[model samples]
Target: MNRTTRHLGHRARPVLGRSGVALCRIGWLALALAVPSARADDWLTGAPLARQLASPVDVAWSGSPLRPSLERLARAQRVAILLDRRVDPDRPIELRLLDAPLADVFEELAAREGLGVTLCDGVVYVGPPETARKLRTLSALKTEEARGLPAAVSRKALARAAMRWEDFATP
Candidate 1:
């Protein structure tokens, strides 16, 4: 019995052979491995910056200057952080913690320095208490104002206007 076929002057052999079965098994295995499996901490996946801030960290500083310590933390956590000019960056700080959430550490520092900490548009802002209080409210208002625009324009405007220190400052 002849089982081969010809197309465009080329012979095509049957593919369901030993090698084909092995290929199929390999494909199934690959697919099974590629699917995302459920995790216990799946709830932590929301809001990337929030997730990063929620990460447990160990920090030990003895009279370290504020600006450099914040820069180091930002680098280590791969997150954006801003220190408002109104806040004294050169202020000496003492922080010692083991396996603490990064947000808690920021709160502690803010309290100790008589400043404020707020997360706006993915960047952590450390500044005057009044500015921090108003940042989120202003961001919400701007967002609501952009809601009527077309999706692309809205996205562009939002990205361009990512919460800046100038937005909170009144001249």
Candidate 2:
């Protein structure tokens, strides 16, 4: 007798039978849940520093030096702000805002100075346009690279270790 036997396995099994379909659906669901969905404003929402940067502040600067103004703001907000060496710290800037978020203030300042601003590693970096544009991408790449290493190595890579001048020997 020539009866079709699905239990025989090999060519007898269907490509996507009940079990296969169920497994595929479960796999897709697991994948969806495993990887988080992100939005453009995720950084502002997720990071505490980012959220702090979004808090409103009343700024009044009348021909104030860039560096001192930024330092004051950083001190007040308790957030790290790094102004690139290339940018002129003593450059005078005039700004007045009743109540504006720090991020918007940074954007306006950058625009006026023809510079770029970016937040990386819980610090706001103000620098050349190209550097600002690449900072986030560079940070992401570093994080991704670290994730592939062993736990101890990854922790060391991520840690912000400060070195003194004595750590290096004269060549």
Highest TM-score against the true fold, candidate: 2
Candidate 2: which stretches are off by over 4 Å?
A: 1-46, 162-171
Candidate 1 deviant stretches above 4 angstroms: 1-46, 150-156, 161-171
Best by lDDT: 2
Each model's TM-score?
0.63, 0.65
Error of 1 at 45 (Å): 10
Q: What is the lDDT of residue 38 in candidate 2?
A: 20
**Residue 22 of model 2: what lDDT?**
30
Candidate 2 whole-model C-alpha lDDT, 0 to 1: 0.55
Task: Report the C-alpha displacement of residue 67, candidate 1, in angstroms.
Answer: 0.5
